[model samples]
Target chain A: MKAAEKRRITRMTSAGRVELDDAVAVEKKVRVAVNGEEVMSLYCSPERVRELIVGLFMTEGIIEGRWCIDEMTVEYGDEILVDIPADGKVSLDRGTLISGCLGGVTFSSSAGGGPAAAGEVRIGAERLRALFAEFQRTPGLYELTGCIHNAAVSDDERIIAHAEDIGRHNAVDKVIGRCLIEGITLEDKIMHVSGRLSSEMASKCARWKIPVLVSRAAPTSLAIDIAERSGITMIGFMRPSRFNVYTHAYRIL
Target chain B: MKAAEKRRITRMTSAGRVELDDAVAVEKKVRVAVNGEEVMSLYCSPERVRELIVGLFMTEGIIEGRWCIDEMTVEYGDEILVDIPADGKVSLDRGTLISGCLGGVTFSSSAGGGPAAAGEVRIGAERLRALFAEFQRTPGLYELTGCIHNAAVSDDERIIAHAEDIGRHNAVDKVIGRCLIEGITLEDKIMHVSGRLSSEMASKCARWKIPVLVSRAAPTSLAIDIAERSGITMIGFMRPSRFNVYTHAYRIL
Candidate 1:
C-alpha cells in the first residue's frame, strides 16, 4: 500500500507564489469489525494493515481465546474495511480502557501491567548514538512526507524491524505487532520512536516488555513516572551528539 | 497551575553521564464527570482545566441544551478531578464518535460538516507572515518544556486568545472552548497551531468554521482533503519566509 501521494500545491514565499508537487502522508480510516459487529475506526497510514490490526488486538486485549489474522478480510478504497473473526469472546471495554487524546492508555501504576523485564543489555553511549543515527537514516515514509512517525525495534547489533504510520502509536503498534506475529521476542530489545514519550507511548513499551525506550523528542512528566515504575530504560531528546537518560541509566554502559 | 516542573535527569554524551535538572511537561489525568456520572479521562496539561473541558464538551457535542463551565469543579493533585453539573442531558456516544489514534473525528464528506462559511477574510501574504511570526514569538508552555502544543485564535490585527496543552487536539479545544465561552466569533478568525495538520486538526477547525488555518508543520493527505471539503484555507510548513497552501487559495490575498 502507498504510504504517501504527491499532489500539486501552491507555495508562497517573499519572492512570489509557485506551484509544485508536494508529498503528503496518506491516512485512511480502517473500520474494524469483530464477528460482524462494527467496532472502531483506525486512522493510520495505508500500509501495514495486518500488522496494525494484530498489534492493536494483542495490545488492546481483543483476543480472548482463539483468533487468526488470515480469517480477516481487508478491502481497500477511499476507506479501508476490515472484518476480524476471532473465535474467542472479545472484550468490549477496550474503548474505555484506552480512551481520549494522545492515544490515552491508562495502566494502573502499581499492579497493572507489570514492569518490563529488567534490562542488562548495555551499549556504550557513542555506539548507541551511531546506532540511532543509522536507524534514523534508514528512513522510509518520513523522507517522502515529514508528517509520518516511525517506530523500530533493534538489538545491540543493528535494526531488526520497523514500521511507519500517520499516527505515532499506530507505528509503534505496527512494529511491535509484526514482531508478535513473526514470533520475535520483544524482551531485552530497544524500541525507538519518532515522537514525544507521552504516557501512552511509555505504557505501550512497558506493556510489551521493551527494555529501552528512545525518542528524538522530549518526555512528559507522567512518561518519566511510568518509566521509573515500569523498570524500563527511558531516553529522550536523543540527538546525535548527546542524549538524556530519564530512568534506568544502567542500560547505557 | 504550573504547566511544567523541573526534575533531575542524567545526561549522557560521548564524554560520559552527568546529572542535570530538566523541565518536563506536566501531564495529569483529569477525570471528567458530568452530572455525577464519570465520563472520560482527559490526559492533558494541568492548567486551563475549565477551558479544556469546555472546548472538549462543546466540540465533542457533550452539551445537549443548557450547560455552563462555571458549574464545573476541578480539584488538583497527583491526578486532577473534575465534576460538571450539566443542566442538560449529555450524550454518552462521544467515546464512540471521537475514537482511536491522533484525535480522530469522523466528518461525513457528503452532508457532514458543511463547508466553512465562504471565507472573505483576506490578509496580505506579508502581513500574515508577520502575524504568524509574532504569534509564535509569544511563548507560553512550549518555551518551558518544549513538549506542549499551542493553538491561538487570531483576527487580522492580533492574536485574541490562545491555549496550551500536551495533546494537540486538547490545545485546539482549549482555545476554541475559550472562545466559545467568551463569545468570540470564530467565523472570521485564523487559527495558528504548532503541529502537523492531521485529520482531526483539520476537522476541528472545519467544525468550528475557522476560515484560515496556519501551521509550522506539514499536513496529512486526509487533512488536506478535509480542508478542501470544508472550504478552509490550509497553509502549512509555515516557516518565516515560505508556506504551502493546500486548499482555498483565495483566502490568501
Candidate 2:
C-alpha cells in the first residue's frame, strides 16, 4: 500500500490560519479488465487496488467458489490496470451502474432474493457498545483525510477484517473480499460500516448472508425493508450505550 | 415534491429508551429511458424525477442544446418509469457508473475539458461566510430525516435553488436540472453541498462551469486536482468564521 501524500494546503482555524502540509488521501482510477475487455474503472485510494477488484468479483459472483483467476497482474505505471483471468464466464458487457457513493458496476440486480440464513446469534447490548467504541477509536485514512468510509467484519470478541475506501460500498466489498480470500467464514458474523445503511449496503450484506449489519448512521426505508426480508439483524445509530435495531431484533439480545 | 414520511421508530437514548415517530426521507427508483431504451435507474427522493433526468442528460452531454427533449412522461404506477424521447442520439449502452454515494451513471468520461468561463467573478470572504451560515441554517429534509444530502446553488445574497436526495451527486444533478429547466444560467454561481468533495463532485461542478464550490466537509486529493485544472474555485470546511480555499483563490476576495 502506498502512503498518503503530504501536500501543502491552507488551513483555517478558529483563532487564526496558516499554511501547512497535510496528509491527503490519494485516489486514482484503476481499470479492472477481465480477460481482455475493460469491465469498469474505480476512482479509489491507491492502496488495496487488488483486494478491491478481487472483492468486487467475489461479491458480484463472477468467481464462484475459490479464486478462479488464472493470472493477475497490476500495472502501476502512469495508469493503473489490473488484468485478471476472464475465464469466459465473467460477462463484461452486462454491467449495470449501481447506486453507490463511489461509482460501482455490478453484473446483476442486487436484490434481496438469496436463501435466508438458518442460525441464531445473540449479541449483548453492552458488547455492541464496546465494539462500537473500539470501532470508533480504530481509525486510519478517515482520520487523515476525513473523507473515507470504512467497513469491518468482526466476531463477538474482536474485529477480524477491516477495509476503508472512498466509497462505502467498496469498503464493504474489500472487507468481504478479504474474508473470502483468507477463507474466513462470514455466517453469523457482524458487519459494521461508517456510512448510512442504504439498500445497496443492505444488498451487499444480504449477498454475504451476514446476520448482523451495524452502523453509526441511519438506514433508508428500502434498507430496512431489505434487511427485514433477508432476515438480517439491522442496527443503526449506534453509540457507546444505545442503538436502534430495525429488524431481526431477536439476534441482538 | 412529496412530503417526508413520519414513521414510528424505537429510539434508544443514554438515559432510557422510547418509541417515537420520526420524519424519514422517501426514496424510490425511477428508471429513465431515453428514446425508449432503459438506460439507467436512479434511487432518489420521490420528487423531481423529471428535473433529475433532464439534468442528468444535460450534464452527460447527451442532448447538446437547451433541452432537446421532445416529450417526457412519468408513469407513476407500481414501478416508476420515466419515458423521454431518445432523440436518435442518446446512447443507452455507453453509460459509466460514477463514484457517488447514491449510484450515478455518466454517459461519457466526465473529464474537466470544456470551454472555460468568460470574465472574472470575485466573492468576498465575509460574504461567503455569511452565505455558508445561511446555508447551514436553511435546512429542510436534512432536519427531518438526517439521512439526505443536499446541493444548493446560491449567489452572494441568498440561495437560488436547492435539491435533496439520498445521494449527494443526485442532489447536485437535481439542483442543476432545476436550474436548467428554469432557464437559469449557471455561470459564476456558487454550488454548495453537504457531502465531502470528491473528484466526481468536482467533475459535476466543472461540467456546469460553476465558478466556486463550497463544502462543509473535507475534499479528496483528486477533487483539488480537478478544481485546480478546471479553474473551479474549491472551498472546504466552510464555517461562519473560516474556510479553506483549495484552488482558484483568486475567486475569493
Candidate 3:
C-alpha cells in the first residue's frame, strides 16, 4: 500500500504568511451490494471501508446487525460490493434510488415517523455546557479539508463514538453503525452534531432510540416540534457557557 | 401581508470581550409542486421564492425554459405550485423527493457517455483571470453569513447572472434559473462556482451546455475525467491571479 501524502498550504495575510500541512484525502467510489445486487455507490476517503460499510448498512436500515450480512467485499478501483443473505425484506426499485449529488443511494423506507420517545437518558445544565466545550475541542476532519461534518455519541460526562463525513447525515449514520458493530447500547447516549439540528437529524436520532440531541448550530421549528413530541431533549446553539434547550427543558436543569 | 421581521443576536467575543449584534436569519420551508404533485421541500430564505422556483426548475432540468411553466403560485405556508402543460417527456416521481438541508438538492444521474462538448466561446487567460478577480468580490451572502456559495455566469468580459445559496449547487441552479427567465443564452457563458469543482458540479454545467466551469477549490479525478470527455474547460483551484485549467486549455488562452 502506498503511504498517504500530506499537502502543505501557504497563505499570505496582510501582516504575514502562515504554512499548514495536513493529510490529503483521496476520493474513492464504493459500490455497496446486497444479495448479489448493487445497492448504492459512495464517494469517501479510503481509510475505513469496513466501518463505513457496516455503519452505512445499519444506519440506512438495510441490515439490522452484522449477522444479517453474509459477506462483504471492498474493491479498490470503482466500487465496493457488499453481499448479504437472501432476505425477503431486501428489494431494489429504480424509483427508490436517491438521485442526488452526494453519495447516491436509497433507504429501504422513508424512515419517517417522529422523534423517538425519550427514555432514561438525562443531563444537567452544567453537564450539557461541559459537553459542548469538549465537543468544540474534539479534532475535526473538516478543519483539515475544509469539508466534512462530525457526529458524536456521548454520555453525561464523556463522548463514546465519534465519526466525520462530508455529509451530516452520513456522520450520524457512521456513529450509529459503530455503536451497532461494537454492541453499544444507544439508549443512554446523547447525540451531538456539528451541523444544525434539522428535523431529519432529530428523526434519525429517534430511530436509534437516542434520548438527547445537541448541536452547535440552530434548530428548525419542525425539529423542535418533533423533539417535543418524541420526548427527546433537543439542545441547540450550544456554547461553552450557554445553550438553548428547545424541548424537555425540565430534564436539563 | 405582514412584513418580514428580522431578529438580531448579540454575541461576545473572547478578544477584549467585544460584543457584536448580527441579524438572525428566518428559516422557512417551501414545498415545490409541479403539476399538482409535490416534488420536494426546501428550507430557504423567504425573500426570493419566484427566482428560486424558476431557478430550481431550470437547473433540475424539470423545465427547459420559462415557456414551459404556464403559471406559478407562491403560497405562503404550503407549496410553490407550478402549472405546466401535459407533455409526454415530463414525468414526476415522488419516491425520489429529497429535502435539502440549507443548500438545495443536487440530483445525480448515471454516468453515461462522456464529458460535455465545449462551446464556441473562447477567451484569453488574462481575461479569465480578471473575471475570477471580479467573481471573488461578488459573494455578498458569504460576506454576511460566512457560510454560503456563489455562482455566476459570465461572458468574455462581463458577468451576466449571479446567485448565492447555502449550497454551491443551489447557486448554480439559481443562476441557470435566472438566465432562463431573462431569456439569456448560456451558449457563450462560462460558469464560475465558489465551491469545489466536483463531478456533480461539472455535470450540472454540462447539462446546460455551459462550456467552461471554474472553481476556487480542488477537483476530483472523476471530475477531470468527465470534463475531458465532455470537451468542457475545467479549471480548479482558481485564484484571482492564477488557475489550473485541467482540460481543454486551448479555449483559455
Local lDDT at B83 for model 1: 88
Against the native complex, each candidate's DockQ, computed on alpha carbons, is 0.72, 0.50, 0.14
Chain A: TM-score in each model? 0.89, 0.85, 0.76
Tens-digit lDDT track of model 2 for B29-141 = 68877668887786777777777877776676554322243357887653579886543455432233222111122233232355654326687788888877777777677
Comparison by TM-score, 1 against 3, better one: 1
Tens-place lDDT digits, model 3, residues A44-104: 6554566666666554455432234323556565544555543444423211212111122
lDDT of 1 by residue, B1-253 (tens): 7889998899987787899998999988889897788888868999888888877776676645555565678999989989877556767554222211112332212212455546579998988888898879886877777798989999999999988889998999999878876767788999999988999898888777888999998899999998998888999989877999999888787
Q: DockQ: which is higher, 2 or 3?
A: 2
Clashing pairs in 1: none
lDDT, residue B33, model 2: 77
Segments of candidate 1 deviating more than 4 angstroms: A92-112, B92-115
Q: What overall lDDT goes with each candidate model?
A: 0.80, 0.73, 0.61
Candidate 2 DockQ vs. native: 0.50
True contacts kept of 3: 0.02
For candidate 2, the per-residue lDDT at A113 reads 46
Off by over 4 Å in 2: A1-3, A12-17, A62-70, A92-113, B1-3, B13-19, B63-70, B92-112
Model 3 scores a C-alpha lDDT of: 0.61
Tens digit of per-residue lDDT, candidate 1, span A1-253: 7889997899998899999998999889899887888778869999989889878777776645556666678889999999877556767554222211112322221212554557577877887777788779885977788888889999888998999888899999999878876767787788989898899898788776788999999899999998898888899999988999999988888
State iRMS for model 2: 2.1
